[model samples]
Target: MMSDENKVGTYPFVAEPFHVDFMERLTMGVLGNHLLNCAGFHAAERGFGIATLNENHYTWVLSRLAIEMEEMPRAYEKFSVQTWVENVYRLFTDRNFAILNQEGKPIGYARSIWAMISMETRKPADLLTLHGGSITDYVCQKDCPIAKPGRIKVEEQQALDEYKIRYSDIDLNGHVNSVKYIEHILDLFPMEWFRQKTVKRFEVAYVAESYYGDTLSFYRQQISENEFDIEVKKNGQEVVVRSKVIFN
Candidate 1:
């Protein structure tokens, strides 16, 4: 049982009022943030964390993420985020997460792909070469049922909105924070839409990085009444990210 601690980690959190939307349900943006923090916590505890890798001029970058939620915790509700490594490859790793309600019932699950990169060259690092490939020791068979992030194409010729990346969007990596893109995509919808429906699933694939002062153009295509595909381009040409949002 003790070995499982090295394989999985569960961190508790509450759906504070500030973390919830006007409907008193936890917002996806905040939930996404918490999920990422759990990833950092799990990795750090296992010695492959960014802080440790940074010492060797290496860092972790998120490549793709997919989150599926059956329900969002309400305000002041107690919940927890559980994370575990699913697989470790040469240059990328698969991580999974579960959001449990107060009763320990899973309300959501997520699957993410990450890569370790050299900060100097900004190139992918060999995961099998790191820490003598001990990262494989943390792999768990625990199930994450959500589908992996799929190809999100937004061929819409019309841009719905445009903005310039600012300091607030930039992270320590000198690029836009992952969650910020989630926030911006959600912003594309009005309260009226959210009032009538709730998000059922969210997925994002980071194709490239966008730095501060870069202009972002948001293009969206409605796949269905409840499904939408979004693409974000830097300088209106280079795709920084693509996303899919499904509502219920």
Candidate 2:
């Protein structure tokens, strides 16, 4: 087994045309999806084998990711991504990742909290106990920022008008993935919408967990048409997720 100390490597990926948006920069979903792929590659380099998880009975699932982009990579640009394990918690492991241009200039950063879950029971297992040994000694730098999920409020009237979650919106975790939620909101508009418009800022908060069979009500209202407040609710109880999208 290659220890984490000897397991460092950089994964190079090209931003293909399919990965870019109308603005000619990487889409939020593609950026996140590629980051996960980078993490998988790094793990495989450590002899973990990218797709294999825990005796063929478990798999790694992304619980949450707090991603921040200083600037987006344009289409056809070559970027190098680096990932490393920071620490392991009881049910979740902390991983840190960074994206840089060909010249090594930083473009974005991301921190992911993931859980090792049983493929049979579909429930998470303790990270330290799953591999039947303590892997903490292999972790790299212990000093990584803790990116907690955020919180936002949705307007009552907007909640009443534009709120409803459909059956196809849920993911394997039984809740909507953060990136997919953004996609849903973006899909509400046409592709031409971005030619004269661009996302200046975007943020989301995962408030509570939702299950696969649960239908949610989505709510949103334009904040002067260029920005909007959005939320997902179940039975008008706890809000599952809240987000704000700003276009310039």
Candidate 3:
């Protein structure tokens, strides 16, 4: 078995005041970005980071993600995110994370699925043979309490919002940034909704890519008073992504 240090990567962070919301807690979008960054840092240290893969015209893509948090760090609080590879498959892998408070106790957790794909052909690559099969060594048995991303289906509901993808919404891959969707989905509700409650969980699954100039139509279905399922379609036809949000 690999040593614990080899199986996991822990990185620290600070909840800057500017990144917090009116409630004085780190915003969901910022937390999502932090989680992605931790995934990058963890993968890079283990030899399969985007930097290394990009050299060969390959990159990691997020397939699905589910984040559950009891609470986010308050403004000016010091925290840390620890990430580990939970399982490795031929063409995909499962990665997990733990969000620790200032005192090193876990306050939240996340589960994610990723696939390494060739940037040129947009095809997934086999993980079993990468780096001479060294990827298997990083797989750990760490427990990630959050459930995997669930199925989100929104039918022909009236569109709640419409957005045109712009320069700022694009990521390095020339597609709408993943975290940007979360930000946009949250805007569908009124400020009163945010001011009155906290977000307890969020889940997103990428279906297809949405490019610049694509007009995205957002549809929402309320699962309950505090939970909702959202779907984003490009140009009123192609489904690009689906998500779920639950509030306290």
Score each candidate by Cα lDDT. 0.92, 0.68, 0.91
Candidate 3, residues 88-195, lDDT tens digits: the string is: 999989999999999999999999999989989988999998778788899888788887888888874799899999999999878999999988988888888877
Residue-by-residue lDDT tens digits, candidate 2, 122-218: 8777777755634454577633443443545677544433434555666655666656666765655568877877665556655566665555667
| lDDT value for model 3 | 0.91
Per-residue lDDT tens digits for candidate 1, residues 1-248, read 33866688999999999989888999988998998999999999989898999998998899999999999999999999999999999989999999999999999999999999999998899999888987888988898888888888788989999989999999887789999999999999998888889999999999999999999999999999899999999998999999999999
TM-score of each: 0.97, 0.71, 0.97
Task: Pick the lDDT winner.
Answer: 1
Question: Model 3, residue 23: what's the lDDT?
Answer: 82
For model 2, what is the C-alpha lDDT against the true structure?
0.68
- For each of the candidates, the C-alpha root-mean-square deviation to the true structure, in angstroms, is 1.3, 4.6, 1.1
Model 1 TM-score, all chains together: 0.97
For candidate 3, report its TM-score: 0.97
